[model samples]
Target chain A: MIWPFITRSLGIATILLLAAIGELLDERAGVLNVGIEGLMLFGGAAGFLAALKWGLLAGFIVGTIVGGAFGLLHAVLSITLKVNQVVSGMGIWLFAMGFVTYWADRYSGPLPMGMVSPSIHGLSPMFFIALAILFAIWFILSRTHLGLKIRSVGEDPSTAEVSGVNVVKIRYLCTTIGGLLGGLAGAFLTLTYLACWSHLPTMGLGWVALALVQFSIWRPPILLAGALLFGFIWQFAISPETIYAGIPAPLPVLRMLPFAVTIIFLTVISSERFRKKWALAKPAALGQPYIKE
Target chain B: MIGLRFPKLKCERIVILTGADAVKISALSVVISFMLFGAFVAFEGTDPLVAYEHIFSFAFDPKLGLPITLHRGFFLVFNTLAFIIPMAAGIWNIGMEGQFYLGTIGAFAVAYSFPDLNQAILIPLMLISGAIFGAAYGALAGFLKGKMNVNEVVVTIMLNNIAFWLVYLLTVGGPWAGIAESTSKPLPKNACAPMVWNTPFTSIFVIVVAILVYFFLKKTTIGYQIRTLGSNPIVAKHVGISAPKISVIVMAIGGAIAGLSGYHMWAGDPAFLMIPRPEAYKAIGDLTYWGIILGLICLLNPLTSVPASIFIGSIIVGTTVLVRRLRMPFGLDVLFLGIISLVFAAFQFFHQYRIRRVKVVIGK
Candidate 1:
């Protein structure tokens, strides 16, 4: 039973882990992609459509491209145009929700048969792909010169610019990469996990990914633990039948477990005593639009 | 004999605009947004002008649209105000949706628990309870942010999901479940506030409250302190203002206003307390985002938020009409809103800077 739970948790965590890692990268580069919610939804729709017509790999590629397009929009608005980051992020989210919903309504047909069957040892191949991506990101961020440049841009763009770093280019690149990951997460959900298209198939998982970034304090290893923790809680809440069939907990209460636990964890980690004991790993320039003077 | 001559360099300057120029820029941005949206509508194979006509007619028609528009506006005024107050204190109270839900639950609990109370007594009791519940909800986030250093954004988002589930459980098959299975029983007759001149009496109440909030923010010392804190928390703290207390106070006030909006939903126009269907709940939750946009448009001023709320309210009503009458897709309003807000944000950038090109020879 415990083994099954671990496996289920990993399967669910794949989507979140990928998205959170992407968000972590974006935030490290001082861009908060709140539109992850919408990006994921759009990715899900695009992936579903592409998967139906061509194949899963094509779906994933198209979904990543779509997500990247929105990320570019955000980068333009927040970095080049110097609009407020929060508003731009929210705009992307809202636009994605509307666009995807519209597309699904007009163009979608019946689900392709056998979409729900597991394709790789009782799990989707995307799980291994996600693990590979995670290790790659960790290597890039921790071991590469480009990673250092991205971090410098996020920490202080003006200083980075003085040191000959192209802040705008780095930010745009990071944001687009973040969007690619978010898009892949959405595709993973529809093409692998749930195996079908639904309105807002990402649900509120995008927001949860945002929270996980903070919970992990922008570190890859900690992020992995956070994602798995949240994924476990989420699966447990929604699939209580798998754990204990006879206990009659209210559905709403069960559904709320993940969010409630998030609140509790946030309160604990945010305590003044906790901060005193361990330094908070927030990016110095997170969420601020850089303007060259 | 060797003389070197240098060519003048071409320079570009960015000028910050002010006063009337800023207003003109903003107006232009609004026009651009409308044109962009019109183009989008045309792309959908509908005549933009015709679509606009249908939208306005459904929103402004006295017999069909005015009452609903006004009803939505009444609630939106409170919701927008709820956002504005905390925003004035430099806090993004994204949890307003949750507070609103809790407020409705609070009001419903009062009305349900004491079904025989007189309107005069029950209404005030319900309002106070609703406000208190909302305040407490807001204060929890405030406390975590102030005392615990939590990011209010994540805390509020999490709280929103929790609040929503709690409400869902209570209303759907729980103790407060009504005969409808998805809604609580209607408030007792006497407990219901009578409609005034074919609209909700709460409309008048909302107007009065809006006025009071405007004065409170404009005239009071605490209000001044809040604005000062928002602009520069460090400076405010240097002058001995307590940051934690102010955070809690502002959030509580915002929560109370949102709670009043929830109360209005329960006892106002369609005077019944129902848990929205899942899709409806998602749409309703998006209302907080709309309120944020309104608050930003109004620059966090209560005086301006009223008109902003009304404007947004009409758009919402118009969009619903478009979907129902014209068979448009369900989420067009949200798309349009996103575009409009994005344009507005861009306009805000333009308001701050103007591009000027200077002619100069370059090569030396």
Candidate 2:
């Protein structure tokens, strides 16, 4: 029982990790893409449909591209036109949530036969992909010139520009990457985990990832740990019918755990004392639109 | 072959926009949003014009859709007011959805316990209790944001999820479980909201509230502070007022307004007087978001939201035609909201900046 739970938790962590890393990159670049939730929804809905028409690989690719395209739109809005980032994010969220939820219902067909996640010893291959991404992100943010560019742009676009960083390009780059990963994470829900189409299948997991970013204080390694723990939560706890049969658990009550914990975590993080103690640097210019005037 | 080439266009920041300029930008946004949605429908192999016609006619047909549309306006008006109030103060009450849920439970608690009370006392009691419950919840988030500098958006979202699940727990197999699966029995008739001329009396109350809010925001000192806070937080902070206090007030008030919508759903709407089934639970929040869209589209002006809410109500009524007749897909209402808002956000840029035709010489 323990082994099965751990493996399944890992699978859940994979989805969270991808989106978290994407968001981390985005925030690090000073573009607070609050629309991560919607991006994931768009990815999941479009990816599921694509997977049905073509294959699993196609689903992942389409999901990634779909996210990238929206990311591009966001970059254009937030970076180029300098539209308010939060509103742009909300617009994207509304559109994707609306469009995806609509079409998911229209095309509520059965999953393709035997479309399970290829696992070795009951552990998903996708978990390893997410781990690799986590490692790559850590390396990029710490060691590479592109990483320096992203952090500098996020910190102060004016300064980055003065120092010849091409702030707009870096922000655009990171935003797109974040959006692509967000979409990919959504695709993972339909293609790998549920292996079928469902309405709003992300079920606040996108928001869970947003919370994870804060909980991790924008660190890839801490985010990975948090994702694994939360993965063992609702998806693991209330999800299984037989495991908690003796406890007479009210499923809806249990479903509140993650969100409640998210609020509690946010409150704790916002406490001045805790922040001064363990806080890694949040991007100073986050949620601010860069103006070169 | 002779080719026609258009001059290059570019956007430059403008110092300020006049009223006419803002109106032009808004008008263009409406056109573009429709064109985009039309393109979407056309992609789905349907004539976009037909869909619009169906939506329009189905929305206004007196016998079938008009009454429901007007009834829906009751909730939208409150929802819009709830959204615009805090938003004008530069606080986002994303918990409108959750607050509405808490409002339902609050009203249910009052009505269930005082079932035999006379109509006058019980009705006001239920409505007041619902508002109080919603206010308490909204204030919690506002207090956290004001005191700690925590982001209200994320906090409200968490609260929304928790509130929804809490309601779900209560309705399904909890103490409130009355006679059916996933729902409760109807409240006593005395507790039901009173109607006048085939409309909930609260509809009149909402209009009065809107006018009062308009005056409060425009003419009152605290309202001045709220508007200042929304426009320039730095300048507002420099003023001697407490940010935390204002945040709490706006959110609590917004929550109170949002809470009334819960009463509207519970005892006001003839169709859904009972606790909603678990399946239809989250769908209720869809109304709150639609109101949010109206609030944003109208630039959070209280008076403007009145007509905007009515217009959106018709569109929402039209969504049924889209799904049932056109087989267009579910959530067309949301898609419409999304596209309009997205296009509007893009066009809102023109309010601050003007596009110019620039001559370009390649290969200098």
Best by TM-score: 2
Model 1 lDDT tens row, B96-135: 8889888888888888899898888998898999999999
How far out, in Å, is residue B59 in model 1?
Answer: 1.1
Q: Summarize candidate 2's per-residue lDDT along B325-344 as a digit string, tens digits.
A: 87777777877888887887
Interface RMSD of each: 2.0, 1.2
Between which residue pairs do clashes occur in model 1? none
Which docking category, incorrect, acceptable, medium or high, applies to candidate 1? medium
- Model 2 lDDT tens row, A1-293: 66777777777888889988999999999999888888888888888889888888888899889988898899999988888888888888888877887678677765778766578888878889989999999999989998888898888889999999998889889999999999999888778877877677787888888888877887788888898888877565556554554656678877898888888888888898777743447888999989886
Task: Residues A130-228, candidate 1: write the lDDT tens digits.
Answer: 778888888888899998998998888899999999999999999988998988888887777777776667768888998888878788888888988
Against the true structure, what is every candidate's RMSD?
3.4, 2.9
- Tell me how many clashing residue pairs each candidate has: 0, 0
What lDDT score is found at residue B85 in candidate 1? 84
**Considering only N, C-alpha and C atoms within 3 Å, which residue pairs clash in candidate 2?**
none
List residue ranges in candidate 2 displaced over 4 A.
A240-245, A277-280, B1-10, B358-364
Error of 1 at A108 (Å): 7.3
